[model samples]
Target: MSKIRGMRRYGFLASSIGVTCAAGLALVPGVLAGAAAAAAPAAPATTAGAAPATGPVTGPAAVPGSTQSLPLAPRAAGRTRGRAVGAALEQGLRRADVRHFSLVGVVWDNPATELHGSVQIRTRSAATGTWSDWQDVDTHNTDHGADPGTAERTGGHIRGATAPLWVGDSDGVDLRVRADTGDRTDDTAAEPPVPLPSGLRLELVDPGDTPGEDGPQTDQPRTGDLSEAATAASAANSGLAPLGATEIPALDRADTERELLDLRGDELTDAQRAEPHIGARPRIVTRRGWGADESLRSPGFVYTKKAKAAFVHHTATGNNYRCSQTPSVIRSIYRYHVKSMGWRDIGYNFLVDKCGTVYEGRAGGVAKAVLGAHTMGFNSNSVGIAVIGTYSRSKPSSAAVKAVARLAAWKLGLYGMNPRGKTYLKSGGGNLYGKGKNVHLNVISGHRDGFATDCPGRKLYAKLGTIRSTAARYQGR
Candidate 1:
C-alpha cells in the first residue's frame, strides 16, 4: 500500500454514521464540553469569579503545548486550478510563519460532516530552511472518534477533523484544502462543489519541551495543585502501584494473577480462578512517567461495561519522531485532541512507540475498561492501541506489533477474553453496522473492522494474525 495508492483507496461506504459538529476549543466541564463555550478564549478565566486560569488549563493557553487555529476562507475566484465544479471551500496556497510546531491538522464546525475533499500541506523546516513536498492529510478520519449519540459524541464543541500530520519541528507552513465536489466541470451546472465543512480551521500543534525541562526526572512531577480529574486518574490504579508512581513494574504470571485476584477477585469465575490464562503483565510507563499534563483533558473518566476487544491503529501523525521523543509526541497529540480537535482526551487507549515501548494513554488505569474516543462506532467495550507512525506503505516495526500483542493479552485476559477468539459488540453506528446492532468481530481487530477507513494502516493490519498468535501464546492458550 503505497501512500498514493492508500489515499486513492480511502473510499467510504454510503451509509457511515455521522454526528453533530461544533467548532472552536474553549474549556468547559461536565460529561462533554467546550462546544457551547467555543467563543471564550482558552485562558484568563472569565467564568465569573474563577481564579484567573493559573495552572494547566484544559483550555490550552495554560499548557506548554498549544494549538494555533487559523480560519480557512474562500479562495479567489480567479484561481485556475482545484475547482471540482465551482469555487467551493478551497483554501488555496495560504502560507504563514508561526511559532514552532511539529504536527498539524484541520478541523471543522460539525462532526457529522465529512470533508469529501483533499488536504495537502508543505512546511519549511525550522532546522534546515528547506521546503518539504506536499503531503496529503488523510481525509477519511471521521472514523477515529466517539460513537454517535453518546455524550462524548454529542458533547458540545466536537468538530469534524482530519488526522493530525506530524511534520517535525517547523516554523513556516503552507496549507491547501479542496472539497471533491464530483467531476462536474460546467460552472452553469446546478450542483456546486461539495463545500468543505463549516468553521474550518488549520490547527498547528507544538508538542512542547522535553519532560525534564521543569523537573529532575523525565517523569516530571505534577506541578501546582492537581485537578480533580487528574486525581481520579491516579486513584484509578491505587492497588496496582503506590500513589503517584510514574510506572508500573512488570509481574510474572503468578504475581500477575495474584495482583488481578487481589484487585478483582470477586468477579472471577471458579474456573477462571482455578486456571487463569492471563499473560505475564508487561511494564507500562504511566501518563506521569511521560509528563502528561493531566489537567488538559476534561475532568472525567468514562468506561465501558467491560473491555472485550482491542482495536489496533496508527497515529498517522507521521514517522518523523525518534523513540526518545515519544512522550513529547504523545503530548502534542493530546493537546491536539483536547485543545485542537475538541475532545475529552487523547483518543487512543494506549500508544506504542516504534521501539515497542508502551505508554498509557487516555488517563485511566491500564487494567480498567476505560472508554476511549478511538474506533468511532466501536469505542464502547473495547481497547484501542495506536502505534506512533503512519504505516500505509511502511512496514510496522516487529517490536511495535509484538507490543500490541503483549498489551492486548494482558488487557483482554483481565476480563477472561481469548485474544484469538471472536466476540460480539453492538454497533454504535458505522458503515459496517448501524447503531444498536450486534456485530461479531475478531477479539483483536483492526480499526477498519469497525469502520470504513484505512487505519492501523495496511502493513500493521496485515500483522494482526501474528499479533493474535503471539498474544495467545503469551496467555498459554
Candidate 2:
C-alpha cells in the first residue's frame, strides 16, 4: 500500500527563534527573555478577531529561526447558516508570502479543547516558487503530549495544537480549517457544525541555518566561552562524550559493557558488573550537533530514578524532509515546543529521523532517565523515542524502526529491562489510566498503548512486536 500522500517535502531556514503564547498571538525573539519568563502568563487579548493575513509576525528579515503566528478567522466560502450549519464558518488564511519557514502547525487556547475540523495547507516552495497541493494536518495530536495535572500540562501557557507539517522552506502559505459535521442521532433538527477551538493561530517555523553551514562547528559552537547553561548541558553528558563533543560515538559491545559498568557504578552488583548485559551504544548527535540554542530551554534538568520502559512516538510533523535536513526539523520543533508550546524543553528523550540517525532530545545525558513530556501519564521511569515524521497514515522507514530497536535495546538494558518482556508504569493520570495506577505495559510500547489516542499511528504500532524481538536480540537475550 502506498501513503495517502507520498513523502512530503519540508525545508527551512533557521535564523532566530521567537516567543508565542495562547493569549498573545505575537512572535517575539527567543533571546528576549528567560524560559520561565517566556512561559509566564500572557495578558488576555482585549479583542477576538482574526489577524490580517499578514505574512510574518515581524518583517521580511524576521528573527533568524522564526515563527509566524497568524490568527484564523471565518471565511465566506463553504460556510452555512440556519440550523444546517448553525452559523457555520470556515476559518482560513488566504495565500500570502511572508517569512522563510519550513514547518507549520495550528494551535489554540485550552489544552483540553479539541479542534473538530480539518486543517489543510498549500505552500509555495521557497526554491521553486511553485505552490504544492493542500496537505492535511493531523488534528488529534493533543494525545501525543503530557498527561493531565502535570506541571507541563497545568502550566497556564500550554495550548491545544494540531500535528505540525514540515513543508520545506516556503515563503508562502494558504490554510483552511473546516469544522466537522457529525452524523445526527435523530432527524429532529439539523446537526450544527462542530465548533473550531478558540484562538486558533497558524505557526510557521524556520529552523534557521544549519549549525556548521553558517556558523562555528559544534565542537566549538561559539566564538567566545560557552554560556554557563550551555556548559552545564554539555557537562551532563561528559560521562559518555567529551565536554563539548558534538556526538557520542558508537561503542562496540565490549566497550559498551565497560561503559555500563562505569556508568552504573554503585548501582551494579559484582555479578552484574562482571556480566553487564547491554547493547552497543549507537552514535547519537548531541543537542549541540543539532544546533539547539541551549538558552531556549528552562534551566536545570529533570530525571526519573531509571528507565523501565520505552514509549515510541511519531513527531507527526509530516514526512516531508530529507535525512540531511533533519537537524533543521528538530531545531524547528525545539523552538516550537519551548517558545510556542511553553514547555521547558522539546518533549521527547530521543529523536530518530527516517534515516535512523538518532539525535539527543531534552538536555539530560542520553544514558540517564531523562523525564520527557512526550507520553502524557506514563513518562516516569521510561524513555520516549520519537520517530521524526507522522506515522499515522504512513509506514516508518526500515532504518527508523531499526534505530528505535537499537536505542531501546541499549537504553532499557541500562536499567536491566528486558525489551521482549513487560513492566509496570504508574500513570500520573491520563485518559486511559488513573493516577498512581501501576499499569502493566510492554517494556517497549507504542504511545497509544498507554494513552487512548492514536499515537505512533496504526502502521508504526503494528511494528512494535517486531521492534521488541529485534531489540531483545541486540541485548543478546
Clashes of 2: 17
Give the TM-scores of the predictions, in the order they appear: 0.82, 0.83
lDDT of each: 0.74, 0.73
lDDT of 1 by residue, 1-477 (tens): 001111211111111011122211212353134332332223221212222323332322133677788887777543334333344557644565698888999988888889988999999899998989999998777898878776667768688899988888888888888766655456577365677788888888987774643321434334244454554565545445544456666777766766556444667677777777788888787776676777778764555667789999999988877887788888888888888777888999999989998888987568777778899788888899999999998999999988889999898887888999999998988888899999999999999999988998998899999999999998879
The whole-model C-alpha lDDT of candidate 2 against the native structure comes to: 0.73
Off by over 4 Å in 1: 1-63, 77-89, 181-192, 212-228
- What TM-score does prediction 1 earn? 0.82
* Alpha-carbon shift of residue 89 in model 2 (angstroms): 3.7
Q: What is the lDDT of residue 195 in candidate 2?
A: 84
